[model samples]
Target: MSKKLLATGLAVLTLGSAPMALSHLVKDEAMQSYRQSYFTLIAMNFGPMTAMVKGDMPWDDAKMLALAEDFAAVASVDVARAFGPGSDKGTTRAKPEIWENTEDFLEKYAALQTASKGLLAAAQSGDRAAIGGAIKETGGACKACHDEYKAKDYLY
Candidate 1:
């Protein structure tokens, strides 16, 4: 089946199987707020790494590893729980299609998680070349998701 179809199927199965639990599920606003805070952390940590890699800032091994760890922690969050119903309609750049195309978003998130781990490992290895490659791949993963599921401007 197509990704969209698969995503739809999964959504149906999940909701269909958990009616009682979902009845009291967290509010969309809470999810949106948490997701926004998570992304803010991502930006805070990722910006310095990118700047260092791009030569806009001086590099430091200890700092790179610390930032990478912070990024990895954020990447570990289960985004499937964050983009639930109505989250797209608030103070976010998240596109509504993220909820509709859940499988695609999840796959993109998995890529980001992998890239984050690679960056952490690279930072620990203290090899500049490896760290550069890891940073590039991490950036690509982020851009891939943003291109598909994030708006360039505010929805509100």
Candidate 2:
């Protein structure tokens, strides 16, 4: 390879890996906020989900459907990959269990995805019974992963 081409390739590789490399070393408040946002997304979804599963509310199907869609929007990102190797910042509430039990964690997460999508479809079809069933299954997915992976401090 030409010297210029080789140097360009190295530069591209470094830039691509920079986010993972710097996540732990950097103490920027913005990075902290971004990390917090992921947690917040989970919290936001769970709150409404609990009410729906318990039938506490009037069963506003449209609202639940909308939230399910929104949940999917945030669920797709793999923050684990973003953190790369350097992402175990002391501030990170994400448990090392996430890495250790990656396959199981991913399976549970996939269950959440499937359940949420089912919830949305059931809501759209105006099937209250299906909605309840999907909600319960989705809740199970969340709890299963949380029981094993998330930190105790965050659970309470």
Cα lDDT tens digits, model 1, 1-156, are: 899999999999888889764443346567766777778888999999999999999998899989999999888887668777767776778888898898899999899999999999999898999999999999999999999998998786
Which pairs clash (backbone N, Cα, C closer than 3 Å) in model 2? none
Alpha-carbon lDDT, every model:
0.86, 0.69
The best candidate in terms of TM-score: 1
Number of the top lDDT candidate: 1
Each candidate structure's count of clashing pairs: 0, 0
lDDT of 1: 0.86
Off by over 4 Å in 1: 1-28
TM-score of candidate 1 to 2 decimals = 0.79
- lDDT per residue for candidate 2 within 1-156, as digits (tens), equals 899999999999999999976564445444444656765786697568668768676667678777777776676666445444445444665677776777887787777777767766776777778877877777788788778876766321
For model 2 the local lDDT of residue 71 reads 72
